[model samples]
Target: MTIGELAKRSGLTQSRIRFYERIGLLTTVERRANGYRVYPPEALVILRVIAIAQSAGFSLDEIRTLLPDDRAHWDHDALTDTLRRKVADIDALALRLAQRRAQLVTLIDEIEARPDDIDCADNARRVLASLFDGD
Candidate 1:
């Protein structure tokens, strides 16, 4: 199909298709006699895969590694490894976020427990001491 038809079918702009071609993601693109880009029917499926991978937090470079012209030839080992690594990354991020939330909650509790007779500076110092003194 022509670039426009492919764009309409793939839900991607023509420039995006061309950019993918330039980036070596869409290697099946052919050139017509008039120098217009011609795409096969499978281009739409490839574009959809790219969109899905992006939604799944895969970078274009990673997607490029993950995809090939033939789906049957996909490296199951590599795909599995990458997926496992991404899960680990997400797990680490969740742990860090949890720790940060707990720290903030502790700070809020400390601030709220401050006696009304203490000034802001003294309260801050007390909070810092409690936090750093490992109590």
Candidate 2:
């Protein structure tokens, strides 16, 4: 098939396909006498895998390391290790986010609990002190 046909089948733009080829993500394609590129049917599946890996938070550089040129050369152990590491990173991020959320909630409660007669500046000082003192 032609580059246009590959783009239609893979749901990627022609320029993106060309970019992938230039970046070594896509394998070299055959060219005809007219200098137009020709792609095999398997190119569609390769493009889909690249898209899915990106959606799963894999960077293009990481994806390059993960995906071998040929399926037979795939390293199962490396794939498993990389996925496990990503999960660990995600867990650590979740913990940090939870801590930040709790801190924000505490700040909001402190503001809401401020005395009606207190001035805004004093109330702000109290909140700042509480946050710094880890109250």
Candidate 3:
């Protein structure tokens, strides 16, 4: 198939296909007599895999490392290790986000618990002090 056909079938723009080729991510390309690019059917599969990997948080560099020129060969251990590392990173991020959410909830509660007699300025000072003192 031609570049246009590959782009249409892959659901990617022509420029994006060309960019992938230039970046060495899509290597199964051949030039015809008129200088037009021809792509094999496997190009569609590779493009789909690239899109799925990207959506799974794998960077272009990471994807490149995972996808070799020879489709039959894949580093299973490296792929497993990288996936585990990404999961761990996601877990750490979730913990941090939960902590931040709890802190924000605490701050909101503190602000809402201000005394009726105290002015806003004094309440602000009290809240600031309580936060700093870890109260």
Candidate 4:
């Protein structure tokens, strides 16, 4: 297939495909006599892996390190370790997000309980000042 075909097949732009190649995220493709890129259909498999890895929160460098240099060189142990570390990182992030959600819920409750007959603007100013230690 050609670059255009690859782009359409991968749902990426031609420039993005070239950039991925330039940045070493993708292997350099062979060009034909007409100076147009000639991509193998298998390249789509690699591109799909790269896209899914990125969306899964893996960095470009991490993905590069995680993917096998070649299919024949695949290592199951290394893949397991990397995935384990990613799982730990995701767990930590989830815990922090839950804490943030709890704090937000408390703040909302406080706001909801604000005195209705009080001067709301002045009360808000005082609340903001106390919250942030402002003037």
**Residue pairs in steric clash, candidate 4?**
none
Candidate 3 residue 84 C-alpha distance from true site, Å: 1.7
lDDT of 1 by residue, 1-135 (tens): 999999998888899989998898887778889998888887888889889878878899989888865755878898888878877887988999999999999899999899999999999999999998986
For model 1, name the residue pairs that clash: none
Score residue 33 of candidate 4 by CA lDDT: 91
Residue-wise lDDT of candidate 4 within 1-135, one digit each (tens)? 889999999999999899888887677488789898898877888899889888989998998887776755769899889989999999999999999999788667756667777687877766676667633
TM-score, every prediction: 0.75, 0.85, 0.82, 0.82
- Prediction-by-prediction clash tally: 0, 0, 0, 0
Q: Give candidate 4 regions above 4 Å deviation.
A: 121-135
| Among all candidates shown, the one with the greatest lDDT | 3
Off by over 4 Å in 3: none
lDDT assessment of candidate 3? 0.90
Cα distance off (Å), candidate 3, residue 109: 2.2
**Model 1: residues >4 Å from true position, as ranges?**
8-11, 69-72
**Least well predicted 10-residue stretch by lDDT in candidate 1:** 65-74
| Model 3 RMSD vs true structure | 2.2
